[model samples]
Target: MLLRTERQPSAKRSSGRDTTEKPTRGADVMGKGSVLIFEQDKIVRDVVSSTLARAGLEVHPAAELDAALQAFESGKLDAVILGAASAGDGASELIHAASRVSLEVIVLSSSPTIEEAVAFVKAGASDYLAHPARSPELLGRIERILERRRAREDLRSTRQENLKRHGVASLIGSSPAMQRVLNLVDCITDNHDATVLILGESGTGKDLIAKMIHWSGPRAEGPYMNVTCTTLRDTLLESELFGHERGAFTDAKTQKKGLVELADGGTLFLDEIGDMSLAIQSRLLRFLEERAFRRVGGQADLRVNVRVIAATNRNLEEMVARGEFREDLYFRLNVIPIVMPPLRSRKGDVPLLVRHFMNVFHRELHKPVLEIEPALMGQLEAYNWPGNVRELRNLVERAMVLSTTEVLWSVVRRRSRPEAPSEASFRLPPGGVDFDVLEKDLLSQALEAARGHQARAGELLGLNRDQVRYRMLKYGLNSPAPARGGLALRV
Candidate 1:
């Protein structure tokens, strides 16, 4: 829970409405934990800091980047809040640094452009809100982060005895992004029967992430099922997902088991769920809310204790805004969200993935991938992986096929961008060419070289007759070519 002693924003302004009448609590509502606020705006900082300090959370607000980071690393903060700044500012970078130390982060800024909001979340911020937020809203957001953090910490404690490295395609990296994801998974495993939404760009290994969650979770003893949202048509999808009673439809000759049923007491991974049709989504939403489902043409509802983990490349919030997805359903499924980072942002993990891939392909295809060329490594790092990890894996395999030697660079087709400008044509001799003198001399020489024929003169200069004439006109160079192929210009 949030430290509640802070003064709630004055309700006296808006029709004398008080936001919170609840009793005061400390930042350590769960225990004795502190909060940090980093901001340069003195007024905003003071108001927020004072409010939190009064709430009993031990709020420490820093007014500069260095000071903020110092205080961040210098203490064990339950959460970090960064106040407002304009676009192209260091706000995102500041959040990133805070992520390394704090379990939860909240950003307070003005209403941002859609791109800015996406960028903020992508940078590891747990949540963002407009600055000068009401103390009630601020406190609510704080508790969410702190509560989630404590949940994760508890989850980690439970996993300490049995938690092991990710199996097969292990997510190998100590990057802050990966650490948070791991922490989220730890939390998921502790809480049973809660729906988890795995949000990320395609090819960020959402499936692998789901498996990791289930394998380490309380449901590890149960089966795991997968349902691709894009594959089935509307009616078929519904019948298939919820199972169909005998004679439910023309093709439903016998009773069938649903993916949800198969996944009972385990985890159900729904991939590309953002594409699921509204009709099916409605049914799924009911199941999520009631913890039970009714098969096609069945009057009775069947209860299942299965964890629903969904993945999608599309922005569900945008879909909801556009009226394509249900807003209520969106909120229900987003209970515990885990956003995966793209491959381009974490270049440090590239080598680890390369080695892991090499070992897998070596045993299967009987080819050794002992070394990668430095040039190729440079190329891989330089290229923006629009397709993310899936593309990277495919490219590595393609390189292996074309490799005669253990050298891996030749298979990489992307060229390296030039490091610096060097071969431009602008630099000339100390004494630059005299435009007038050179024009006259070139006219005379080209006509002579062409034997005074206009067409031939054009050929000598590697240009068309019209092009030569146009240049001559622009340069004010007029030299007549004789019918016998000789021409000259007088000084």
Candidate 2:
């Protein structure tokens, strides 16, 4: 019973094509979906029918509310176009009847006032349009409504499929850190339109977290669009987010709808927003404040309803202090901040994640059940995961694809060691080496080579995890290391 409106329609286009013409397009004659049109006035009915038919919709014109209700009860109609001006006292009844069938109802009136339109919307009209309906605008509104309905249908099906594929669980973790993340997700399910900021290191599943929030919210039926901020230049990114009008710039041939407009009534995920330039950040801030923007080089302001969800790996607080990021924009986007804990910080979930990946890859590769060697599991649990979950998934996938044996130890054992150094010998010139600096540099290299796994780093230096931990603390390097003896990796 929600309501939406585009604008008051006009009968003539700038090109002077009569909005009432029966479209000659072959596609229009063979329209794909049926629309039930109810209008007592013959002229208005013909005009509305012609416009709908031209948009490739099959129109069933009815001269009375009873006929329209009968057609609606036939259950073949995708939508209903009601001429409220002609229906008189029966307009509300027809709207209610259509809503009962879950059919999208669009109300048409000869002279619709604000109060009347609001009344019709409250009576269950999905959209309200006043005569004479412009052909392009009317067609566009109908198509948009249909598109949103289809998107909702698709979302439901996809959710069901995901439930099956994901073992009826969206996020997997047993640790208290992970439990907190789940709690945060649960808390945000009902707050569909709030701007959300997701902070996480690369490969910690920020994208997945964003999707979870969108799908769990009330606007799940609406579109979910994402823009990767770091991949495109500032200008290109702006064009992508706020499309340019034809002839706006060089190579601009036609007008395009931006992601914000396209994601109406849905969520727009801005991935890696920290990478956006200051100019783009200001533009985004304006859109958030006003809920409207003009296309690049276009004069008219276009309004759209879209919820913003932003994600980034960078530290915005530090960036703000350093004058690299806008402080005001950060506050606007940080309305509801959800930080994703890095995989290393949730070491207790490593085994669970490994099993999940193993099962997924095994099924995908059509391989038998994977056998984990205890030593290999121990090594995996003890190592630090710099790349987070993504790296772990890649590791499991690579092992599944390359190794013939069911046991994964031999396939992945080599990765546990730090990469070998170059063959070049180091020699001091006239100056003596600074031992403290040299030691810190070696520690950094070993940590990097081991992919931040302190235990493996210590192994490279012929020291234990404890010794590596001590050196890291001495150097002011903070990274999680394997606990005393580390968690036991199951066979």
For lDDT, the strongest prediction is: 2
Off by over 4 Å in 1: 1-169, 404-491
Candidate 2 off by > 4 Å: 1-98, 101-155, 162-168, 403-491
Per-residue CA lDDT of model 2 for 61-179, tens digit only, reads: 99977788789767788788888777789987888888787788888777777888888888888888866666665676677666766676787898666444432156878989888
Report the CA-based lDDT of candidate 1 relative to the real structure.
0.72
Worst 10 contiguous positions by lDDT, candidate 1: 1-10
Encode model 1's per-residue lDDT on 228-328: one tens digit a residue. 88778999888778998999999889999899898998889999898898998899989998889999989999998898999887789999998999999
| Per-residue lDDT of 434 in model 2 | 66
TM-score of 2: 0.60
- TM-scores of the models, in the given order? 0.51, 0.60
lDDT of 2: 0.78
